[model samples]
Target: MSTAVVPGIEEIARVQGRTVRVLAAGQVLGGVSFGATVSLGALLAADLSGEESLSGFATAAVTLGAALCAIPLARLAGVRGRRFALTLGNAFALAGIAIVILSAALRLFPLLLAGVILIGAGNAGNLQSRFAATDLATPRRRGRDLGTVVWATTVGGVLGPLMITPGEALGAVVGMPPLTGAYLFSIVAQVAALVLYLVALRPDPLALAQRIALSAGPSGPVVESDRPVAARYAMLAVAASHVVMASVMAMTPIHLSHIAHAAHGGHAVETTEITLLVGTTIALHVLGMYGASPLFGWLADRIGRVTTILAGLGILTLALGTLTLWPDEQPAVVVGLFLLGLGWSAGTVAGSALLTESTPIARRPRRQGLSDTTMTASAAVGSVLAGIVLGGPGYGALALIALAIVAVTALLSPLGRR
Candidate 1:
C-alpha cells in the first residue's frame, strides 16, 4: 500500500508538471502571436495606404478589446474555471487571426481592425496567464512561478519578428501578395497556441484553486481589505506606469520616422530602414519587459510589494527623464526605451503580487481583471495621446508628463504604509 501510494503521488506530481508546462507553452505562443501582430501592423498599413495613423489605430484596437474584455473574461474564468476560459480566449484569437488573414488577402483595412480587436480579446486571456500561475503555486513561491511564465513570453516574443521574414517568404511562393502571408503565419501561431493550451492545461487551475481553498478552510490574520485609499492609489500607480510605458514605446517608430525624415532634409523617409528600426526597438522593449520579471517578482514577495512598486516608478522617472534630454540620439533613445520596459515589468509584477496578496481568493479574479482593464485602458489612451503629443508638443513635453505621473505615484505610495 505504501509503495502504491508513492507511485501514485509521483504520477500526480508528473501530471501537474505537464500541466504547468502546457500553460507556459500556451503563454509563450500567445506572446509570439501578439508580437507578430504588433510588428506586422505598420507593414500592413504601409502596404495599404502608407498612413501612420492607421497602424496606430490597429494597435489601439487590440488594447481596447483587452480593456473591454478583461474583467468579464476573468469573472468567467473564476466561475467556470481556467480550461474553458482559456480555450474561449484561444478561439477568439484563432477567429481573429483568420479574419485578419482574410482581410489582408482581400485588401480590407477595416476588417483588419476588427480582426485586431478579436486578437486583443485573446490578449486579455494571455495577460491572465501570470495569475493562473499564481493560483497553482505555493504562496512562498508564487511570485517566482508568475515570473517564470512571464519569462517564457520573452522566448517567443523574441522570435516573432523573425517569423515575419519567413511569412513574407511563404507569401512569395503562395502568391498572396506582399504582407498578407504574415497574417497567415499569425493564424498558424494562434491555432497552435490554442492546441497547446487544450492539451496541456489539463486540470483547470481555477477549479484546483477552488478545491485548495475549500480544503484549507481559511482563517488568518488577514489585512483589512477595506482601505479604499490604498486600492485607488495602487490602481493609479498601475495605470500611470502602463501609460508611460505605452506612450513612449508605441511612439518609437514615429520618432524614428522623424529622424529618417530629418536625415533626408525634411522629406518623407525610406521604408526598409524604418521597418527594421521599429522591429528592433520593439523586440528590445519586450526583452526588457520579461527578462527581469523573475527577479522583481521575487523581490516583491520579500521586501514588500508597495516598496517595489515605488522603486519601479522611480525607474520610470529616470527613463523618461533620460529620453527628454537626448531625444535625437538613437543609442540613448533605445536604452531609455529599454528602461521603460524594465520599469513596467517591475511595476506590473510588484503591483500584481500586492493585489493578489491583499485580496481574498474568491474575489481575486474580479479584482485582477479590474486592475488589468484599467492598465490596458490607460495604455490605449496613452497611445492615442502620444500621437497627438508627438505631433504637437513632441517628445520633450511627453517625457515631462510621464515624470509628473511618476511623481503622483510616489506621493500615493504612502497610502499602503502601515
Candidate 2:
C-alpha cells in the first residue's frame, strides 16, 4: 500500500523560512562573542603565561571544551529539542564570560582557561545551529539553507574583532584589564543571543520535522541505516579541515605581533598598530570564512558534496603553500589566512551536508555530535602542536605540518576517487 505524503512544499517552506531567520539572528549575535574571543584568546594566553609558546593553549582549551561538550549538547538536542540545547549552551557561555572577566581581573591563569573552555561549550552550540537549519529543509535546498546560516556569522564575526579597540577603552574606563574588555562585549552579545533563541525559535524545528516524517508513514525521509564508512569519511573531512584552520589561526596573532615588533627594529609593537593589524587581518579572514558560503553551498549541491570537499582540500593546500613560502610577508599572510577561512567554509559546509544526507534521521543528531566532537578534539591537539612548532621551528614549519595533514586527509577522502 502507498504511504501518506509528507507535508506540502508551502508548509515546509514556511517552516524552513522561519527557522532560518531565527537561526541566522542567533548566529549573528553569537558570532560577535566568538569573533572577539578568537581575536583575543591567544593574546590573553600569552599575557597570562608570560610565554608565547603557551598561547595556543588558550584556543586549545576552548576547542577541548567544545569537544567535551559536543556529545552532551547533541544528546540534549536529541532529547529536549534545539531550543533547549541552544539556550543552555548560551547560558554556559554567559557564565563563562563572567568568569573570564573575573579571571582577568585576578590574573588567575587557571580560571581564565576554565572560563574560556565554558565559552567553547557555547561555541559548540553555535556550530550545531547550522544543522538545525536543515531539519525542515528540502533535500534539494539543504546545502543552500545550511550555507545561509553559516554565512550569517560573517556580520558579527567581522564586527567583533573591530570592537577590540573600543572594548579596551571601555575596560580601561571601568578598571578592567585590557584583554578582558572584549569579553564584556561578548557577554552582552551572548545574552542577546540567548534571549533571541529563547523567544524566537518557536515550535522547535527538529521536533516538527520528526512529526511530519512520522505522519508521512513508511515512505517518509526516515531511514533505518546508513553507510558507516561514508559517514566516517565525511567526519574526517570536516575534522581535518578544522584542524588546519584552528592550528594556523590560533597562532596567527602571535606571529603578526612578532613580525610587527621585529619590523620596528626590536621595539615593542604599538598597541594601536597591533590592534589594527590583528583586527583587519582577522576581519578579512572571517569574511573569507563566511562571506561566500552560499556560493559554496550552491556548488556543493550542483557539483556534488564529495567534489566540493576536494575543492576545499585544494584551496587549503594553496593557503598553506602561501604561508609556507612567505611566512614574513604581511600581504601574503593575509591572503593565506583568507584562503584558510574559505577552505574551512567549503570543507565544513560540504562535509556537513554529506554527513546529514547519508545518515538516518534517528541517528543524525548523535552522529553530527560525534563528528563535531572529533573535529574539535583533533583541532585542540593540532593547536597544542602548533604552539610547539611555532615556538621551535616557527610559522613556516607549522604551515608545512598542516599541509602534510591536508594531504593525508585528501588521500583518505571518499571523494578522492570521485
Candidate 3:
C-alpha cells in the first residue's frame, strides 16, 4: 500500500501560491513556443515541401502529436510528479525547435513534420498545467484559481506572434534562414519554461497532493474517483467544447482565404495580404480565448460549473448563428470567430475545474490525462471533419453543422452533475 502522507492545509495553501506563479510563468513562455510555431509551421512546411497543399498537414501533425502524448504524459505525472512531466514536455518542445531549424536548413520535409509533431506533444503538457493549478485548491475557489493561471496565457499568446519580427531579426543576426528564426524564440521560451518547471515547481504539486490525499486513508479522500458519472461528464464537457472550437476555428481561415480570392475577382493577391487578414482575425480569436478566461473562471466559481458550461454553449450558438447568417461578410466572420474563442475559454476552464474536484485524488492523474486525450482527439477529428464539411456544402453550412454539435452538447449538459 502507498504510504499515507498528506500535505498540511497551511503548507498546501502556501505552496499553491508559489505553484500558480511558476505555472503562470511557464504558460507565458509556453505561449511563445506554441504561438510562434503554429503560425509559422505550415509556412515552413510549404516552403520546404514545395507543395502548398501539404501545408495543411502541419497543424494536423501537431494536433495528432498532442493527442498521442496527452495520456502518457498525464500518466507520467501520476507516477513521477507534475514537475517531472512538465519539464519533460517542455524539453521535448525545445528539442523540436532544434529539429525544425535543422530540417528547414536541410530542405527536409519529412524531418520538418517530425519536428512539428514533437512541438504538438509539448503542447499536451502545457494543456495539463491548468489542471495542476487545481490539485490543492479549495472547491469554493477552484475555478477562480484555475482561471487566474489561464488568464496568464493572454500575455504570452498575444506576445508570441508579435515576437516573430524580432525573432526573425535575431535569427538573421545569427545567420538563421528566413521563417526559421521565429523558432529560435520558441527554443528560448520553451527552455525557460523547462528551467522554471525544474527550479520553481518545487515539492511537486501532484505528488504532494497525493500525499495529502493518502493521509485521508489508503483509498485517499474523495472516493468519487470510483464513480464514473461525474468524471465522465466533466471530461465530456471539456472534449465537446474543444471539438466545437477546433472545428470552427480550423475552417475560419480557409473560408476567409476563399473570400479574399473571390473578392479579388480571381486576381492573384499577395499571400502575405491574405495571411495578414487571416492572422489578424485569428489573433482576435485567440484573445477572446485566453484574455477573458479569468472572468469566465470567476463566473464558473460564482455561477456554478455546469451553468457556465451551458452559457458557453449559448455563446457558441450565437457565434455560429452569425457565421451561418453572414458567411460572406468579413466583419461578421471576425466577430463570430472572436465569440467562438470566448465560448471555448469558458467551457475549458470551468470543465477543467469540475473535473479536478469530481475525480478522486488517487486516480486524478490518469483521469485528467484521459480527459485531455479525449479533448485533443475529439478536436483532431472535428477539425478534419470540418474541412470536409466546409469543402462540400460551404462555410455557412459548416457553421450550421457545428451549431448542431453545440446543440447536442447542450442536450447532454442537462445530464451533467453540478
Estimated TM-score for each candidate: 0.88, 0.96, 0.91
The candidate that wins on TM-score is 2
Task: Score each candidate by Cα lDDT.
Answer: 0.74, 0.88, 0.81
> What is the TM-score ranking, best to worst?
2, 3, 1
Candidate 3, residues 1-418, lDDT tens digits: the string is 2555555567678888898999999998898888777667656766788854455556766777788999999989989998988998998787788888989889899998898889889999999899889887777778888988888877777677566666777888999977777777777788888888998999787887776666644322223445467668878889888888877776666677778988999788775666567667777787888899989989999998889989988998999999999999999999998999899998899888878877778778888989988888877777666666766787799889889878987888865674
List residue ranges in candidate 3 displaced over 4 A. Answer: 1-7, 44-55, 106-108, 165-178, 216-227
Better of 2 and 3 by TM-score: 2
Candidate 2 lDDT tens digits, 1-418: 1124566657667878998999999999998999988888898888888889999998898999899999999988988889999999999899888888888878888888999899999999999998998887767788889999999999999999898988888988989886778777888889999999899898788776666656734423333347777788889999999999999999999999988998999987778689779988998999999998888889988988888888999999999999999999999999999999999999999999888888877788999999999999999999999999999999999999999989998888754323
**Model 1, residue 66: C-alpha shift (Å):** 0.4
Candidate 1, residue 236: the lDDT equals: 70
lDDT pick, better of 1 and 3:
3
Deviation of model 1 at 380, angstroms: 1.4
Model 2's alpha-carbon lDDT is 0.88
- The superposed Cα distance between candidate 3 and the true structure at residue 358, in angstroms, equals 1.4
Better of 1 and 2 by TM-score: 2
